[model samples]
Target: MARPSSDRLGYLLVAPTVLILLSITAFPLAYNLWNSLRHVVLTDPSSAGFAGLENYRALLGDPQFAQVLARTSLFTVVSVSVQMAVGLMVALVLHRRFRGRGLVRAAVLIPWAVPTVVAAISWKTMLDPQSGVLSFLFGVDTAWLAGEWTAWIAIAVADGWKTVPFVAIILLAGLQVIPGDIYEAARVDGSGAWHAFWKLTLPLLKPALMVALIFRTLSALLIFDVIFILTGGGPGDTTETLSYVTWREFLVESDFGGGGAVSVLMLVLSLVIAGAYTRLFRLDRREG
Candidate 1:
């Protein structure tokens, strides 16, 4: 009886936190669903009308939405791939000790620590056409943000620059945890550095690589702040992503119903990506 009462008290203690989470996250989700089913205009509350699935249908048929989805997929894939590759290289290079290695590691982390908005703005300045260093050094007058493909590249570079450090840090932790004696034993067996890295390092680093890739991929999928600051989803909607579309719908167009549909789509995409990652990684193997 006393144990049951103690358990009840513990539940009571955690109840508030649970309620707060529901209030913040779950409530909005429920509200969005409800709003999506109705024709609700923020500027005109009188326009509230039950539209059922019309908002969803409208969004699905919107060509602009399709284009945005494609752009988002491309951005996620390209940016995450580049970030992972570069970050892995950085981690491997930093794995070995050398003079000023510690200082270099700290300096590389500066991009990660900087605010996203500031980084985007800084990159924008550096890529500016007339007075930009890149334009001057390359001897080309290219408008990065004014073009569709260029805008995506700009966004990717900005996103990668900020996130590569994080991936390197995660991989570095994984590398440090690897037993040094394993390398020594491999060397005794006449395994060269390249062979050891391929056979031993790669195998041991799978979990960390998966983790880094997932983190970077998910972050890239929902990229918005940098793009918004840099392009505002302009250049003829060339760089518009899902999040950008949703923002424009809710804030710019003031169509809560349409925005709700976009939000639902985003949620679905996130779940699908998460499911795919889980299946690909076979995390169940670890459980067994």
Candidate 2:
């Protein structure tokens, strides 16, 4: 009886928070799902009718949407991979005691603290062929955003510069929690630095690595502000991502059904990526 009462009390304590979360998240999601199934064109209000997955069918088979999806996937993979590698390197460097380590860490984190739009704008100016610092230094007047691959590279670099620091901070925290005794023991066993790091550090760092990967992957999937500010999906829509397509559908073209479907797809993609990471890393299971 006491256990049941305690559980009831626990539920009562959490009920308000649960309701609040549902009100904010569940309500909007339900609304979006509802809209995704109906043809609610802003221009053709009278033509609004039940779409019944028609919007999804059209968008899924859309060549333009297909291209955007591919670009978004590629961007996510490249951005997350680069961020993880660079972040791991930084974390390793910072894990060691050095002169002005605090200052160096803080300096590295400054970019992470900067606003996304501001960073995007700054990078755009730097990469601009006319009167841009990078172009001036290289002594070439080629437009970076005008090229297909160069445009993606520019966006990835800007995003990586702003985000790699966050990954490093997370990884650094993971590195700090590791016991020094273990490394000393490895050294006693004549284990080289590379052997210890490869055998011990990476295995222990899986949790943090998965976390950083998922977060950065999700951010890359929904990437819009940076691309919007830098390129605006220009150069023949080659730079447009799924999120960008959704915005164009809903806001630009006023295709409510199509936009809502794309938005739902994005939500699904995020969940899938997060779930895959969690499962791949077995984050829930305790290491023996």
Candidate 3:
């Protein structure tokens, strides 16, 4: 009887907080779903009606949306891959005992600490063809953000510069928790640095790698600020992502139903990607 009473009291204590959280998150989601199922163009109020799945069907049938989806996926893959590679290298370097190691660590975090908009703007300025430092150094007059591939390269570099430190920090934490004795034993067994890293370090770093990969992948998939500030999805909408499309629908086109549908789709995509990453990591752990 006492145990049951105590459990009830505990539940009562947390009930308010749980309810608040649900109200904040669940209510908005429910509203968005409702909005998605109706035609709600702000400019054309008389045309509003029940849309059912019409918005989704229209989005799916559009060739531009298909291109945007593919572009977003490719950008996510490229940005996450580059960030992981560079971050791992930085983590390995930071793990070593060196002069001014603390300073180097702090310096490495400066890029990540900067605001995303500021970072994007800085990159935009640096890539300016007429007066940019990069153009002067490379002795080329190419407009970095004017071309399709070059613009992507610029965005990738900017995003990587801002995010690689976060991945490195996560990896560095994982590295620190690893037992040094294992490395000593490997060295005694005549295993070289590369062999030890491949056979021992990587296996132990899986959890941190998974965390970093999931975070960076999701951020890349929903990327908006950098593209908004730098390219504005210009040079013929080549860099526009799903998030941008959603924004265009809601804010630009005044199509609330279309925007709501895009938002719901984005939510679904995020959930699916997160679940996939969690499952993949679990599988890797089981295999290991």
Candidate 4:
């Protein structure tokens, strides 16, 4: 038998990995899409049948779903904006040549390194009405998780604390790769620090910013864990996000069809947002 060529061998090597991906990701996605198009209520298996676009129509007509979408959008915007701003500041500081810089960077990563569940639980404890440190500091016994607005704030704080470090590290890497000679050249041209940051640093940092934005936006849009653990979508469903609602449909209500519909919609929204960011970044690059 003739030996396989390099190109054929490369495909052969990757074939198994591709097969694994198809088995896990592609199979589940296809199954979900099928489920989304049919009624699949575990509680009423006898009535399960082709739903067509019924579930999608129902969800779109639901005021609660509209609220969930609005809330999720707000959360994504707020969380991502705050994370980017704080992350950029942290990255800038870390990019400086200060003593104990490495130690500081490692310390800054502690929040990101901590597991999400642990961070969420810790935040819950800290925001407890009676004995929480935050309540004591504010000099009020307000129940942070009992109020709708306060609950949102607490969730944002917890999410931002855990994720800001990751954004900072990514931005810091971007900053490191930026040739220092650019700054030197700016200095030679009598450019101020603020001017260079606006004109040079931000323009060059667009790629990294785009990356962090997409990741944070998607995570925020699908936020569940912190809300689940912290508030259980409490304060009268005020914190119930799209993911939480989907989970409720699948597990609580045993409505797989509805859950799959929500999941499909979420996937579409994520793709749209990601594509928008990518397109915007490419346009900015071209214009620059």
Candidate 5:
């Protein structure tokens, strides 16, 4: 055989990585898509057959799914917004030159470093109605996770507590890359801190914000671990997210086809949110 060019050699070198990705990710995705078009109720093995678009159509027509999607959207929106706002504050504080800043930064990361399930379980224990810390301290014995709305709040609080530090870390990275000279110039021009942040910091931090938003939004939309540990979509499906619903279908109900359809829908929702953020921020364009 003739000697391969550098380009060809590069492709050959990358081929293994590409193949590995296809095997792990693409293969499962393809299989899920295939399954979504069929009947896959585990209780009815003999019922498996091609039923093009039936799963999708039935899912769309499901009022319960509609409720689940809306709740998921609400959770994602509220959690991401809260995380970003809190993260921005923490990032600003971390960016400041102060004593013990290093320790503070590391300490902030503890929650993020902890495993999600562990953190959720810890929160669940702490929020227990009868004898939990909150109940003991407040002296009212309010059941934090008993009611529908309260359970959602408890889940959001737990998720936010665990993930806010991560958002802070990302935002801090973005904040550091910004040139100090720009802020100095703004100050010299009589721009107040609030004004400068609104005009300069936000615009400059657009790239990082977009990245954090996409990550957190996707995480929020697909939120399951916290819900699983804290609420279990219980109290009559009040906290039922789409990801939880998918899990219920596949494992609890043993309807692989329906679960596959929901998985596809989740993927589409993620793509749509990512695309919206990219377009909203004009992320691809070079700012002159």
Candidate 6:
């Protein structure tokens, strides 16, 4: 029949993309699972044999893994929270039409347009202890990456600067989609701007805010390039995140088995967080 032939043609048309996704994503994940169960190391690739769950057990027992997990959680929590706050403020300001609004919007996106490596290098230069702009401007020579707190601050600054604009853009789109009549109605009901914002705007913007938070949280959890280029997980590994630890295991220490285990753990953590967000968003959407 024509319908059967059409379905077959459609399947053939989409087959290549599905095959590519499976090859690139599914295959690597499967390979990593197999690799994690082995004892492969840089110096003993030939002697590598199945080690079962030993790598995962060792990873769980390692205290450094615990510290990295803690640091990663703090980083993701603090950075995502700050980025959302700043982004919401920016979005609220841009929601209203004003003179040079388009120019302002474009300017805000400039930070987001810059590459992560470039932003990291720039922030590192700006925050350097000696001959840095902050020290020169403030007349205080403080090492931004020398102390754990300072290093975290520097990393947060760079990340928030780069990502806040993305959150703002998403929220701005949501704000624009909101009907103007709602605000007019609130005004007619003698509601102050603050009341209307907190009562109406915030509730309406919940879906967009959740989406932005999930995106920013995931990205913040996987933060590496900025910290790597800026602090190198220095100050006695105080700034070492899970991604950094994973990178060090595979690339620096050349322990494929341990690295694969870390990768699996990272994947699981991300999935858990994403799943929570997905469930919350679905519930919100149903209510809305």
Give lDDT per model, in order. 0.90, 0.92, 0.94, 0.94, 0.92, 0.92
Tell me the tens digit of each residue's lDDT in model 3 across 140-244: 988989999999888888989899999999999999999999999999999999999999999999999999999999999999999999899987899899999
- lDDT for model 3: 0.94
Which residue segments of model 2 deviate by more than 4 Å? 1-16, 283-288
Q: For model 1, how does the per-residue alpha-carbon lDDT over 1-288 read when each residue is reduced to its tens digit?
A: 699999999999999999999999999999998988999888988988999999999988988788888879988887888888899999998989999999999998999999999999999999999988999999998898898778878888898899999999999989999999999999999999999989999878888998998778777888899999999888878888889988988999899999998898888888888888878778645764
Top-scoring candidate (TM-score): 6
Please give the ranking of all candidate structures by lDDT, highest first, separated by commas. 3, 4, 6, 5, 2, 1
What is the Cα-based lDDT of residue 134 in candidate 6?
A: 96
Q: What TM-score do all the candidates reach, one by one? A: 0.94, 0.94, 0.95, 0.96, 0.95, 0.97
Model 1 alpha-carbon miss at residue 171, Å? 1.0
Per-structure clash totals for the candidates: 0, 0, 0, 0, 0, 0
TM-score of 2: 0.94
Q: On a 0 to 100 scale, what is the lDDT of residue 64 in model 3?
A: 94
> What is the C-alpha lDDT profile of model 6 across 1-288, one tens digit per residue?
699999999999999999999999999999999999999898767978999999999999999889889889988998898899999999999988899999999999999999999999999899987988999999999887999888888889999999999999999998988899999999999999999999999999887998899899998999999999998999988988889988999998899999999999999999999999999889977886
TM-score of 1: 0.94
Query: Taking the tens digit of each residue's C-alpha lDDT, what string does model 5 give over 166-285?
Result: 999999999999999999999999999999999999988988888898999999999999999998888888999999999999999999899999999999989998899888777456
Task: At residue 271, give the lDDT of candidate 4.
Answer: 92
Give the Cα RMSD of candidate 6: 1.1
RMSD of each: 1.9, 2.1, 1.6, 1.5, 1.7, 1.1
- What lDDT does model 1 reach? 0.90
Better of 3 and 6 by TM-score: 6
**Model 6 quality (TM-score):** 0.97
C-alpha lDDT of residue 206 in model 2: 80
